[model samples]
Target: MNFKEQLTRFPILETVAKAAAELGVEAYIIGGFVRDLILSRASKDIDVVSVGNGIELAERVAARLGPDVFVSIYKNFGTAQIRQCDLEIEFVGARKESYRTDSRKPAVEDGTLSDDQNRRDFTINAMGISLNKDTFGELVDPFEGVRDLKRKIIRTPLEPEITFSDDPLRMMRAIRFASQLNFDIEPDTFDAIIKMKERIGIVSAERISDELNKIILSPTPSYGFKLLYHAGILAIMFPEMIELLGVETIDGKGHKDNFYHTLQVLDNVAQHTDDLWLRWAAILHDIAKPATKKFDKKVGWSFHNHEEVGARMVPVIFRRMKLPLNEKMRFVKKLVRLHLRPIVLSKEEITDSAMRRLLVEAGEDIEALMKLCRADITSKNPDKVKRFLHNFDLVEQKLKDLEERDKLRNFQPVITGEIIMETFGLKPAKEVGIIKEIVREAILEGIIPNEYEPAFAYMVHEGEKLGLSVQSTGTTFE
Candidate 1:
């Protein structure tokens, strides 16, 4: 297929062709841009490979396109970059690579286009379109990448073992691409990843997490997790998650496999929202099940307080995975702790008081929490799913009504310890805390409106009962 029409989107392609012809250099649009174009997917980043110094070609192209075009050159890596409008174009010299056993960094040497294509990670990315005067938009497919694209397969241009061994991160990339594109990994390539799973250790945590995030953001993340688990890469990289697999039975009672259940929840949430932290909440919602597993004669299996336990485990897991320990981590922790709250409300009589507490605790994350609770319904019985969903709607309605009336989302008590201290003419002490707790409980329990007058009256009564009287004249409750 002719990609000449696609190149018309950027007028600079003509300038690049003219410049390459003048300099006697061969240039082509390669890698992801080519692959995405063939698949009819939209892409903003374009990569170019040239037979001569990529920096020189980029400089000439930049000169032809005038001063507004910016060209950045990295001499050591034999690469250059150009930014124009909304497009970022990266230029690299045609080169071959050979890797040492212990490191992923490749020994680079200048070579022909064929050598460059041979070094690519996958067949889909190895396809290129020439920009020389003789063949301005002819595609070069040394590995029959077009056929592979038609068949929807992810296979390396070179030997699978050698390709993956040279850069173990490609193994993850292969699976990530399969998940993203809904393609299948060829049997030999899949086995190669399994055999070379140990080599993934050489990859940096940041790089691995980057790819994992992409997989998590895919339409169905369970595909990527299954591939990772089957290839043994998940065990090496994320042993904590791998441990969630399997069911241990005692006296003919066993808990469900939390690992598979987590994946199912993840996929279900992915279908609803693309928020990364919410997806993470799904992954970790039941993380403590294995740790808190117990069995009783009457109860088949129980994971008591898994939410609290899982909340405590979030920081350790984030640290191990090299994820940020900022508000994002805290958000996921909060969701894990409160994941079961909505479910409990669904089972019992939905109450405004319980919904108010949930809203206050969840704050802005209440909707995300509800989404997770809905996804957690993984029952095989259709009636059970329907009943839970119907109850969940009622619970959501109660939450909305309570929030509208009480304004309790992220609400703090109107009464403060400072007011208590001033009214009782005392320093910080247990009496002040007791008064504050009583007022807060009174407001939450609907015994008193959240207005200041009622809270102040209740505070005074509690303080008087504790043998303290108002001493400051100006400190009347506002």
Candidate 2:
């Protein structure tokens, strides 16, 4: 049961022990570092807890480690952090915390190591390894965190209700940990989460979004979403997503549950790529289905233009959740807008012109869009899924061939409005626009090569048809 051998791997732990012994303080490596060490997960953030002044201990440790080690101290929080050898070691005094009902912030007071462990959110993180000379590397696991680690269950170190209620953000952390480790939430702990779901409102949106991102990055994000939904957190924090839940039947016809469909798409996308924004695209691809839904005797149920509608919703969601509204937001929006195009193309015949427009619009994101489309094919019928995938293969091959032949992506027709204006002796008029559109369409439809010569010739012809004769010859615009 001695992890002293394992502790020797990090020389900094020894330096910390030496420093704490000099200061007559009890020091332990606690929280995530300990949990990950036992689980064999790679972790660089080390949480160090000492029963005496943490900042002073860290300063002494930094001095003992040598001049190269720099310690940053936050006096208000009674914490110190040292960045050494590509690792971040955070130091804090052993303490207990009591919180007000309106806030997650705790009134902290110095306490024993046991009190500190009791204040931890989950059992796995409650385990600590002493870093004192007397007991260097002896584990202090009062909550049997080793058993929970072996069981692969996430449970509170204390009563779940009190643990999560003290810091509602812990509920989000619990779900995130379950998703990341592919572990189960203990029934009582989960029930406690359901009982205290409303407490999450006191937590900040940014914190919730951080946990949500971790969940989305998990191997099976659907697990986190399902837990959030069933436990009522999603309804409180993400009502829009919750609205995607249920199917309404009219005249005995019900549409597929868009909520589960979204989760299936999310899982499928997760299997293909670890890109967080792409996973978000899958989450939001049909987000507007509920809003755009209609029932018709002819079509049973329809969610027409959900992609476009959903794309518009992305910015609002991002703004609300405090997610970046930069190009990342645009990427997710673009994917959502184009998610159905490839699917529709697969269902119908794939055409060069359709592929050209898609290539031009999707530009650099065409591949990501196609990946999302394939993941969106979540048919319960295996044969139907296979057929759609095969059709998608054809569409993909066609795209590759088109891109290889024409280099149509990010392509503008060689004929430009400025050239049309100079050649046809016109200002920026309807004739110029007509000529440009005609040549652009001709190149896309393969009526002419994407080269300058044919496009210029076609532009002249279109201009002549518009009752304008070429007054001067001009070079094609770049």
Candidate 3:
């Protein structure tokens, strides 16, 4: 494809061209930016490969763009980045690499542009466009990248084994790209990934988790997941998900594969929300089924307390995967634990007390929790699915009505521990906790409205049962 006109789309390319000519070095726009340009996809990050010192070229270009343009240099990596408005232009010297068996980090040295293209992960990403004065907008694809792009295929620029063995993270990127673009990985390259799947052990957990998170956030994550499992990468990196894969049969009765079931729920949740943590919750919602699976003559099969067990596993998995162990982790844990509560509430006789408990427990996250519960209903029979959804609608309406009337979503008990202590003239003991629990439970159980008077009266009565007397009368705790 002739890209002469496209090269003129960005004025900075001209500035880069002038700098390359002045510095007497060959320069080109290469890799994903060129591939994306050919695909008519919008991309702002430009990768510039020069035959000489990339930092010097970037400095010259930054000078041309005026003092306001900033170039951030990474001396160790031999790369420089220029921030020009919304565009990020990365400059690197074309180079060859040699890898050691134990590490993914490669030994780097300056080389011709051909050498750089030879080391690229995929043919499509190996495509480049010249920006030098003599060869402006010339397409360089020694690997037949354009043809592969036309075929909607992912293939290594070199031998698949050598390409993947050099940097094992490319394996994850392969699946991520396929999932993102809905393309196919060439059979040979896919087989090479399976052959070299163990090479991924050299990659850091943080980097692996980053790619995993990207796959999770993709439109159809199940596609990437299946690829991972087939390639054996999923089993190595995340065994918990693998544990959910098989179904056991007993006495002509069997449990549906929770693995595929979880994927369907993930896809279902993906249709409605793009929240990464919520999708993570979907993935882990039934992760403990393998551990909790049991068979009974009467019930056939049951995964008792799987939600709680799965919730407890969240932190361990997050820690192992190098995911953040903060509120995001807490969110996933909370959802995993409470995922079944709403399902039970929907399938049974809906009660205000149950709704109130859910509202208070979920607080501001009730809406998101309800979305997950709805996605969890993956019945093939339309009538059963419809009935569950109808019951969910009733539960949702009750939540809205009760939440508005009682304002329990963010409710705090009117009786505080300090107040309980002051009222009973006691220390911070179990009695103080019991009295506080009574007031909070009373408000949530509809024993009284979340108003102060009834909560206070009930608190006094309970305190009296504990053999404590109120020090003052006609006094409000509000």
Candidate 4:
């Protein structure tokens, strides 16, 4: 079918056609842009394949567009990219590639459009649309990409084994596409992935993490992760997560499969937010359960202090995965550590002190932590879920009331060690730290108000007990 009508939306394609014609070369809009267009998915990135010099075509197109338009060229790779308006169009010479066994990087030489299509990672992405004046909107489907698109299947253009072995990252891409588009991986292609899963070790950690992050960000992330698990890729890529799988029974009592439970929580969180790090928190919330798992005749099974252990594991996992180690990792770690706190509050009595502590610790992330806790309730029994949700609602309301009344979100003690030193005319010492801790705990424990006056009064009283006399007093602690 001709996409002439749809192609009208992107007037940029016309400019490309003009540029290609002036250069006396053939060009086609190929890869993801074509695939997404067929699926009616919005895409701002376009890939244009030229049978001749792509860099020259990009320069010509940039010149025709305007002086303001600039082409960024990577001469070593024979590719050029232009950012025009809200769209990014990359130009590359159509090429067939041969890879060394050790690297995914290919030895490239210019080839026909057919050769380029043959080298695409998946069939749907192999389809191309002509950009020449003679066949401007004609579809090129040598691999029946349109049929694969209709069938909602992910399949390689060449032999699956050959495609994956040439660049094993394509195996992850296959699962990523299936997760993003809600498509099925064809049986042969999936089998090829399992057989060649070990090849993923050669892929860079950053590259694998990029694909894993995309999978985590998909509408339903668990689908992609399950595929990775069954394909044995997850074991190779992230063994910590694989350790969370399976159930063990003792005396006919068993715990829930923490692996599947984590996936359910992941899916549940996906329904509420698109935050990648938060979803990662879900993935790791119970990651330490396997390590902490133990059984007693009375309690059946318990994963004691799993959250704390899991929190410690987050940085190691992030470091190994090549994920960012900044506040993003801290955020995920914080959530993993505190995930059980809200649930524990929901189950038991919701106290002002508990709310205060939770609010103070979670600070700006209380809402995100709450989202994770709600998602963590993955019981199959409808009644248990309903009851827990009711309790969570009560706990949530209590948090709102306490936060509004106490103003404890991002709370810090009004009294500082400097203030304590100045009041007692003392140097920096263990006494100053001790007095500061007293005032801070008093505020969180609700023994005194968080206001400066009450905290100061309490601090002076506590100082007197520490065998220190107050030399001066101020109404303002700051």
Task: State which candidate has the highest lDDT.
Answer: 4
Residue 147 local lDDT, model 3 = 96
lDDT of 1 by residue, 214-269 (tens): 99999999999999999999999988788899988888888778899999999999
* Ranking according to TM-score, highest score first: 4, 3, 1, 2
Give stretches of model 3 more than 4 Å off: 473-476
Each prediction's TM-score versus the true structure: 0.96, 0.95, 0.97, 0.99
The Cα local distance difference test for each model comes to: 0.90, 0.91, 0.92, 0.94
Error of 1 at 445 (Å): 1.3
Model 3 over residues 96-139: C-alpha lDDT tens digits?
99999888999999999999999999998999999977679999
Q: lDDT (0-100) at residue 239 of candidate 3?
A: 94
Query: Which scores greater on TM-score, model 2 or model 3?
Result: 3
lDDT of 2: 0.91
**Model 4 per-residue lDDT tens digits across residues 257-276:** 99999999999999999999
Better of 1 and 2 by lDDT: 2
lDDT, candidate 2, 331-397, per-residue tens: 9999999998998899897788899989988999999999999999988899999999999999999
